[model samples]
Target chain A: MARIVGSIMSTHVPSIAGAMSRHAEGEPYWKPFFDGYEPVRAWLDEVRPDVAVVVHNDHGLNFFLDKMPTFAVGCAPQYLHADEGWGIPEVEPFPGDPQLSWHLVESLIGEEFDLTTCQEMLVDHAVTNPMQLCWPDPDDRAAIRIVPVTVNTVMFPYPSARRCYALGEAIGRAITSYDAEEDLKVVLMGTGGLSHQLEGRRAGFINKEFDLRFLESLTEEPAWATQYSGEDLVRLTGSQGVELLMWLTARAALLGGARKVTSNYHIPISNTAAGTVVLEPAA
Target chain B: MGTGTTRHEIPGTTIFDGAEAQKGYALNKMCFSFNDGTNRAAFLDDEEAYCHRYGLSDDQTKAIRDRDVLRLLELGGHPYYLAKFAGIFRLDVQDLGALQTGLSKEEFQARLVAAGR
Candidate 1:
């Protein structure tokens, strides 16, 4: 069976990519956010999972309001990042595991989660930013293919906290049952949130207190998150912060328990609070 | 938690639900097309013609012409997609927020900094 060795939760902000390309090593404004990802990069090297399942939301790049799916998984053999206007520096395509992708698609549907299967997609920075943060060096990209599981955070009815956690439970089951013969190490990722409203009068709002508590609960009392309502999330978190449902889904996949290996939180990475926490199954 | 058909009534924000989705389809589609650089340039070259090409309603066309962020939101223009439309006018999110909240650009930026506190 494929072993879900670990998981990562992060804020996939687009400006972080600009900071990276500009080599903001010594710049005070950018260094903290970049520094925050340092340990995350080290952890990726240490665990070196064979593949990563990226859970993220598309920001009007791949899916517009026309036909946004509540949940979609990239089934292509290779996924490329698209130019999301204003020329965010491009990167090489992320390798994908099509066979494993199809397996999960069939299995998840059987598990009663009908996910839209995408054969071709231009992944936006919502997924790529966190990917680059975890795996900074190109040399490290080898051996770690990606399977993108995108959620609809742009429009509602987003997958609820309960449904998200349940999706993770389903993912945990799917990974264990598939490819029992192969010795595969998998890393699951859920990216987005930690508060900060992007639109309306309350733009740039961040809840550090609520955000930190969420990190604590995500690692310790994940089941408690299921009770969060749309209003509760919107009231506490920003409108965009509701995207934390993505993390709950990933946390649910780990099932029983996990230990947070690293945690990083920084304020206002271009109008959003940025955070990352790496978890490994408890010993 | 169902399909985004649920109605939400936030004090100052439009939820971009099914009804707004229908209302803003043409305008949003036009904005979404700005992902392609060529479309962005074409829209810049002749915005009125471009709006008409997409069959946008008079309100949406007026909103685009006026660079009115709040009006666009009221007309069902999604903030994320409308951002592309705003980008054509070189207005960033902070600038747009400045317009909606009646703050100067500098004041809006200051408020953003204060929000992190």
Candidate 2:
């Protein structure tokens, strides 16, 4: 059986990669955002999980409008990175855990969640940025394997909060039930959100009040957000702010009450109200 | 299950719904192609011919030519895909936000910083 380490929810803003490429974390403009990750990095060092199950949304790197899957799970042996239109430099490919991936795919489908399985998936910044944020050193990043579970946030008719939460629950069950002979420690990650829209006249929209409350709800009332529809979330948060759905799904995967170990909320990280939270399930 | 009948309007924002997706297929498909460097270079070489090859609507072609962020959005462009189009000119989200809001880049950035306070 696999042991759950905890869950980490982060905002996967692409500009972070640009700043990182320039080695600008110490610069005044980026210091505050960069400092927030120190505690998380320390925690990761302590837990030292062997595998990370990343729950994120793709921003037009892998799947285009031609055929969008509502929920897709990567079962590949390795995942590569590509140019995401912007000039952000691509990172090294991340190793994957195919054995665990197949078990998850089997368990999730048995639990009645039909998911599109990908043998080869190209992850965009949404997946890479968080990895870099956690493991800034290239060697540290390469040590752990990854399993990407992407939900559709690129298009409308996204999976409802309830559905995303349920998916998280199934993920928790599947991870715990894996019949591994060796002991395994797995970390779950939810990437993106904290409210900021980047389209239409409301291009610079940010709802701090809503973002703060939503962050609080993650620990106190994990299912609090499930009450709202996708439209409601977009209205309250912002078009892109709705990426908070990824956070909810990751938080729900904890499967029980959890205490917020640490959280950082900052504004204007490249058109986003950037936020990150680490939750440890109640004992 | 069919919640499309009831539309929720968020002022100053456009939801990329099924209808919007249908309308922007050609334009978005063209934008998606920009993921490849060659396609981006080709689009820059001859903008009009590129638009024709993508089967873009006259309005969409004009929107591309004018680099009108708001108009392209009105024509059903997804911000994510339009972002690829914006990259041809090296414009990031802040630039797009400034363009759509009719504000200078500095003003838009300040507004975002102020949101935290």
Candidate 3:
């Protein structure tokens, strides 16, 4: 049977790509953010997950307004990164775990959560940046395969925190029940926010109070955030900041309560509040 | 609540719901095209023609021509797709933030950093 080793909730701000491309991690402005990953890298070295189930939202790189699905899973053998029109150099393609993706799709649908399954999907910065953050070395990245699970955070009418949590539970059920030849170690990755908006007059909005509380809730009281409505989340976290739904879903995927391993928070990572948290299932 | 029935207002923010989507379709369509280098180059070559091809509303066209970030949002532009449009002019989110808030880039950045403390 396959098993989830742990889960990672991270910020996928696009500008982080430029900072990395310039190798500016040691620069004064980016040092704090980069330094946060040290412990995360150490944890990864210890756990050594064979596959990563990345839960993120696409930022206009794959699905568009033409047709949007509330939830989509990629079953492609290879997922490529493309130009986001912002001139950030595209990263290498991610090798996909199609078998696990299909298993997730079948189990999730069986669990009554309808999802769109794609055999071809273009991964945007949201997927690419965090992958790079986790495995800074290409060789380390090569060892792990990926299964991309995207939620509709780019537009309004988003799935509720509670609904996303339930989806995560279904994902956990699927992964735990997956019958495979070898025992597979999987890491659940939730990539997005910690309060920051980028539109209207509140373009640079960052709610530290809400972010800290939300971060605390992830482990201390996992479902604490599900109490708020989508509008409430946007009002409290900012438009793009509401991307924390990704965090909730990933956290919920841990069958048992989670134990916080390491966490980091910083402001104004390219008009967004950037954060990262690692949680392993409680023993 | 996940139910999509009710609507609530968030000051200084526009929820890109169904109505906003309908209103900004053409403008966002044009912006989404920027994901391709050739389309970005074509838009740079003739902004008006590209806007015309996308059937952008006169207001949206003027907003795009003026590079008015706030006006584009008012005209129903989503930040995600509008970002690609901003890319054509080499504007990052910080630049967009400054423009929308009527602050200098440095001032806007300072405001963000201050949010942490």
Candidate 4:
């Protein structure tokens, strides 16, 4: 049986790449964001998940406005990171576990969630940043494999919050049922906002109140988080904050309940508030 | 591609939904090309020729000429792809914030700091 070891929710703000590449450790402006992921490294050490079901959104790298899917799961043998403009140095290709990726595609389809399955494509910052943050060292990254799940947060009319929740549930069911040798341990990771808009007059908007409330609701009353509409999401959190819905999928995967391990929230990571949470199943 | 849009009732935000994706396809394709440095230089060298090469509609051509974020949004330019176009002009997405809010860049930066407070 496949076992979901835990879930890690994070912010994939691209600038972190520059900060890390530039060795911004001692720099006060970038320290908090870098420091924020320290615990994730420890947690990854402790959990040692066999695979990560990384849920992230694209930034016009893979699917242009041309053919964006509501949800896409990559089943390729390897997914290379792309130069997201400004030429962020490409990292080594992320290893993929096709068996599990296919398992998810088959199971999710059986559960009535139509997801685009990609055999070939490169991932952008959203997926790579979290990996870089949690396991910053290259050798550490090679130890584990990934099943990249891309969500639609870039374009408008997001997958309803309820649907995101249900999708998580389906993902949970799928992972728990995959008959793998030696009981594969899994980690479900969700990336994107806490608050802070990237466009429009209301841009630069960071509702820390709403960000905290969102984190609280997601960690506690997850069902209630599902009740929010897209407008309400934007009204409460900001335009980009609607990306929090991606977190719902991971929250739903915690077979028991989100036994919050630890969480961090910080503001102004290039026009966004960054948040991270580590959740394990309650006894 | 935009057909699966969840339903956009968010006011003041023109979502790049399926209809918008279909409408702004050519414009976005042009912007997406900006991911390559040479392509960006090409656009900078001959903006009209670049737009024409991508089969940009007249409105999109005008929007590119004007560097109008709002007009591009009206033309179905998805925020992410549009950011690439804005990048060519050395304008970050935050620049769009200042542009939309009718504030200076520092003023916009202050507003972001203010909101967090």
What pairs collide in candidate 2?
none
lDDT of 3 by residue, B69-90 (tens): 8989989899999999998889
Question: Which 10-residue window in model 1 chain A sums to the lowest lDDT?
Answer: A135-144
Model 2 alpha-carbon miss at residue B57, Å = 1.0
TM-score of chain B of 1: 0.87
Q: Give stretches of model 3 more than 4 Å off.
A: B1-6
The DockQ value obtained for model 1 is: 0.50
Error of 4 at A33 (Å): 2.1
DockQ-wise, the better of 1 and 4 is: 4
Backbone clashes in candidate 3 total 0
Over A100-201, each residue of candidate 2 has an lDDT whose tens digit, in order, gives 999999999999998999999999998999999999998998999999999998888999999999999999999999998889999999999989898999
Q: What are the runs in model 2 whose C-alpha is more than 4 Å off? A: B1-4
Decreasing DockQ order of the candidates: 2, 3, 4, 1
DockQ of every candidate structure? 0.50, 0.85, 0.81, 0.54
All candidates' lDDT scores? 0.81, 0.92, 0.91, 0.83
Error of 1 at B108 (Å): 3.2
Q: What is residue B88's positional error in candidate 3, in angstroms? A: 1.1
lDDT of 4 at A168: 90
Tell how far residue B50 is off in model 3, in angstroms: 0.6
Better of 2 and 4 by TM-score: 2
Q: 1 or 4, which is superior by TM-score? A: 1
Error of model 1, residue A275, in angstroms: 1.1
lDDT of 4 by residue, B1-117 (tens): 446536646556655556887898899898899988889899889999999999999999998899888778888787788888876676766678889778898888787767666
